[model samples]
Target: MIEDPQGTILALFAAFCRVGGCFLVLPGFSSARIAMQVRLFLAVAISMAVLPIMWDTIYPKVSGPTSTYIGIIAIETVIGGVIGLITRYYVLGLQFAGTVLTMMIGFTGPPSQDILEDAAENQLTNLISLTGLTVLFMMDFHHVVMRALVDSYTAMPMGGTFSPQGALISLTDALSQTFTIMLSLASPFILYGLLFNVAVGLVNKLAPQLPIYFISLPFLITGGMFLLYFGISSLLEIFANGFVPVFEGR
Candidate 1:
């Protein structure tokens, strides 16, 4: 049934370069917990599904010289990576905010194995990050990323000249926006930590003989935990709501 098997194969591989490249660094997909084989199969399946929709745009591009085809593959991979990095940076920003939140609340428990990765992380930080990621999955954030990947064909096109400058600018903009959003989310905790520490410092000054620092640790953690219990729902709600505008705006 295939009139041009070679061309079809080339087109599919071309599509795979982009989709697989995106998955290579995508958040949940690229998690260390996910096996490489599973990621590869999922990428291949998605590439196959996407190839037909993009057949007209992609097929013609592959019937070119070997050198040109190789160049296209590289460019497509970078384009896909840039797209993936945008989302990755945003999620990483949330993780950073979690770290800040834990510090502010004085929750300095020993680091434990991360729920999603091999690295050790603060227990509260892990909870916040995992909760935010779970909310993202529940809201189907991957669908948004896939939709952006599809639209990227229109925006970047196949075999077009790669723009490192433009790509860098996009990433920088994503970081900037992510920082602002994450900062706002962690502001209350930052303020709480500062105020709580200041009050504790004054108490220590008043009772120099007392082990105020030791005495205050429990209260600091308890207050922080209480704040988190009351505010976590709001934090995640804002975090999830902000993802769309930041991702699409970039």
Candidate 2:
């Protein structure tokens, strides 16, 4: 077998581009704070590590030295993106829960300083996103991402076609689950806000000029902080328990 060095280089380059592009958008791996050079190096390292294993199975099926290579690259990019998107969807759900709870506790709208995006945002959303990302890394939930990365090639191999309908359905399912979790986490704060609002309304009715509504803000904020402090452990535990089956496809 005459080893075509040009073909080998092209194949590696194509694989690198596809895989690297995917990681550029993947959560944990794709944070803006990381230097571009460092990320590129990491992506290159990943490609080097995995490509040899995949090339024998992947390269033979792919078309040779033409527009077909471009097509294959595009396909791989899509597959990698889908793998990253599924994980990101869940993280967004956790952030959404935090944002909702913050709003319920009267921390509504944008603030002057936002830690995550470097732009104005609801402080609570920013806090939640930061915390969630930190916790994700701390807990090594990134292993699921790595597993998904490996499984991606199995699920949608090189030169293998994508099932648009299946991908759409999967994305929709992930989003739905995210929304459900968000609501579940935020429910306590929502209930607190609702009950407190009603109570305040009743109290106002009994004494219109008592300044009860204005004075209640501090109490609401304080109560919300306490609830969050207490509920965080349970919320994270639920997230970990639920997360196991999600990537596992059980």
Using TM-score as the measure, which candidate wins? 1
The per-residue C-alpha lDDT of model 1 at residue 58 equals: 99
lDDT tens string, model 1, 88-180?
Answer: 998999999999999998888899999878899998888888889889999999999998989999999998998899999999999999999
lDDT of each: 0.93, 0.74
RMSD of 1: 0.8
Q: Candidate 2: lDDT of 162?
A: 74
| Model 2: per-residue Cα lDDT at residue 1 | 64
Q: What is the lDDT of residue 180 in candidate 1?
A: 98
Identify the runs in model 1 with alpha carbons over 4 angstroms from their true place.
none
